[model samples]
Target: MSVQLLIAQLLLLILGLIGVATAAPEKILDHGGKALLALCVTFLAAQVRPRTYLKLAPYAWGVTLLLLVLTLFAGKGAAESGGVKRWLEFGPVRFQPSELAKLGLVLQLASFFSRRGVQNKLISVTAMILLTTGLVLLEPDLGTSVLTFGLGVVVMFAAGVRFSNIGGFLLALTLLALPLADRYLSAHPYILARVFGHLGRDEQVAVGLDQIGMAHRDLQLGGLWGQGPDAPRWTYFAAHTDLIVASVGFATGLLGVTMLLFAYWLIVSTALQVAQLATRVRPMRPEIHGASILASGAMFMIVGQALVNLAVAAGLFPVTGVPLPMVSYGFSSMLTMGLAMGIIHSAMREVYRAQPALADGL
Candidate 1:
């Protein structure tokens, strides 16, 4: 991708994030740097062949896992807002290992599933899910953990695995997740509080559930044209980033939110088209479609996480602090997504090259 295109996209994303900046100029640079890194990493990844990517999967997973562990111990500590322990600092720069882990697991799983023999697919996918999910859950980042698991299952299904196994996996997973969910609710008082707040709990105000309530109210007030650009949403402290949906709703109303979601849906559909094209190629090998599978998973990771973040802002899901992918203010997230996009772009190029007719339009 040309620097011009990257710059343009970065600007659009920044314009949206600008609404929520506290310190204005400083936070913009911090976030912009991360976005630029994502773009750079993406271009680099796109240059590599799927086969080479497969070869590197094991190492990538290992390094990411190590970083997640180090984050638990030596992580530079979470940002000043709430101390979430989700970011790690490297000297002057801070990055989120969880974000990197998201992309890492997607690529690793694509490599893993692409190489699986039909007979061993069930066991192999199961093992990958267990290992990846365990590591992600340890990060205690529930949203990304859910996303990682979802990506693995989607790829396994696409690889022509038996539906019965997918069903069985879901059934068993439901059983396993039930207990975990119960334990989580028991331990995390805030989880239930958030849910209760969403349900219009009156007593929640004293316990700080008022944020959800206030956000919901703000959504209602954003009817039609909204409060206009850069409008204040007192309900959200930094309305542009974490509470973006509500932020947009407050400014542009329902129309802006609709457009944003539509853009995401379009990107996701494009990625699916790429995957379908790659899967239909002649002389098919697992490696041949590896890039496409990774691309599809990457799209899901971004779209799915963004939806979750939006849902939280809309008071649907409990807040997990996940950003709105390319639209959010965080630097690490922007860069990570740019990197993922670069990989997806690479896959698209490869798929197009295989068929000149399709290549022309792109």
Candidate 2:
């Protein structure tokens, strides 16, 4: 599973290199270097025990929350982001806490679910998800917000929490969100525009003239075989980050994109396999099995966010700026996913080491 996961990441990183090089040459070197650093972190994380990740889950989650809150007041983003505070700068490094929150919440939720007789487990998980989601949403990052929420939901359902219970909590959440609607109205015009415009509910907005429109044109220009690196294309903001798939489509064409999709399939499948192995090690309350929960949460987040990014680029969903994991050109995503991949590796290692008999399943 780790081998395949590595292969998948390498392929995606290569895709990132190609996409960034083609659309944003200035960012290619930085992208490559950071990707390498992230992979290094993953390899290093594998050296740690799975139980270590469990022990650290609470700390990780707490720190992530602190970061998320900190970002709201002190974070800064690219000029194109239109003053959205999503990143915190430190000396020479800056990153998005929301990205880190994805993995942090995953580990934290998994830890909570695994422990037996924890009171209000469901509510705890919901609060964690809500807090993380709310912060990202306040950043007005619709894409990461959806991804974080989806991660918690997947973990909750897998933990065997019933639908009715989920719905009840969701309703309560709705009540909480009702009062915050003005935040969206006052601070998220960009988000509202993308969503409403895509649905054709807004008549005054020129919907098709934005970056997404250019992304669509880039895809069409690539055709079945793609136009290669030298293709004539209009560069758009976030071509290397949010709209990377289209960049890949433009440079590599359908064939390249198909390969990219296959890479994702391999990755998601490998993650499932890892999760399966981990679950087997702790058949009863597998969530307590740190590696098992880690694998499961990581797999869901990867596939869920990947699907959203693909849908948006394919014109099936609104542009939500969700970066394709391992494939997007951003330090925060690269490092966060690197940690996820690393901890995932640790989980597999812990499982195999703890139960040598289970190694045969792999």
Candidate 3:
């Protein structure tokens, strides 16, 4: 299973490099090098004791919070970022704290769920989600904000959080969002125009909408294989990052995107099977609930982000700034995903060692 995970990750990394090469040839070396470093971190994380993650969960979650707060106060923005505060700079390097928040929230949920005699679990968990999402939203990174919220939902679902609680909380959130969005969106017409433009209601956003319009044309040009016969044209904003899927599609066609989807499916399905096996391991099952949920939550962040990126590229949803998991050029994103998947690999390895039979198909 670890082997399969590695293969899938490598495939996606190669695809990311291809996307970069197609869109911004000069940056290929930079992204490819970061991808390699991330892959190393993935393998190293897989070798750690699975229980170590549980012990470190609190610290990891705390650090994530601290970094997110720091980002809001002094986060850096990329040339393509339009001054959105999504990164923290140190020396020559920049990192996205929001990336770590995804995994941190997962570990926090699993830790609370697997522990005993925790008071106000619901309130604390809800607060954690809202705070993390709120900070990212303040960065004006609606894409990452939504992605963070979705990651929380995935973790809670995997932890067997009650459906009524989930539903009621979401309902309350929607109520809170309407008025807040009304206030915020008016203050930030960039976001308001994006929403309106996406809905085809903003005639004032032609320049803004050009990105989406060009991406749509590029995707059509890709067809089944890509613009093979035509001079390959990749003229979309964020061509190597948020719009990497469209870039890859333009060069490699729908076949390329489908391959990416299939790779994600393989990884997620295998992880789910590991989680299922952890649930079924009889005497140890109760004790290892955290591990099971951890594995599930890990994939939720990795594969969930992948799906969101795909939806945005396919125009099935509004443009989300969420990059494809391992298939995008962000260094922090690659490293975060590498670490999450590696930790999940560690969990899966622990489970397989305990009940070897569970290792069969997975």
Question: Which candidate achieves the best lDDT against the true structure?
Answer: 3
Error of 1 at 86 (Å): 2.6
Residues 20-118 of candidate 3 have per-residue lDDT tens digits of 888888889999899999989998999886677877888999999999999988998877666678889999988899999988888887777777422
For each candidate in the order shown, give its overall lDDT on alpha carbons. Answer: 0.68, 0.79, 0.81
Sorted by TM-score (best first), the order is: 3, 2, 1
lDDT of 2 by residue, 1-362 (tens): 37877887788888889998888888788988998998898888878776677778899999999999999899898787787888899999988898889998988877777674324547667778988888888886877887888788877766556788878877887898889787777776877776788877885554553677788888888889888876667877778888888899899888878888888887667666666665566444443365667877877777688899888877788877778888888898888777777776776666666667876755
Which 10-residue window of candidate 3 scores lowest in summed lDDT? 113-122
User: What's the distance in Å from true for residue 277, model 3?
Assistant: 0.3
lDDT tens readout by residue for model 1, 1-362: 32333443454365455444421335656666665566667678678766777778878877888888887777655454333356678887788887888777777777877776455736666776777776656545666778778877876666566889889988987897787887765654555665665566646433454565566676687798777654554644445567666665666677767767766766676678787777667767677568677778877877778778878876677666677877777777877788777766676767766764764544
As for TM-score, the candidate ahead, 1 or 3, is: 3
- Candidate 2 Cα lDDT to native: 0.79
The TM-score, computed over Cα atoms with residue i paired to residue i, of candidate 1 is: 0.84
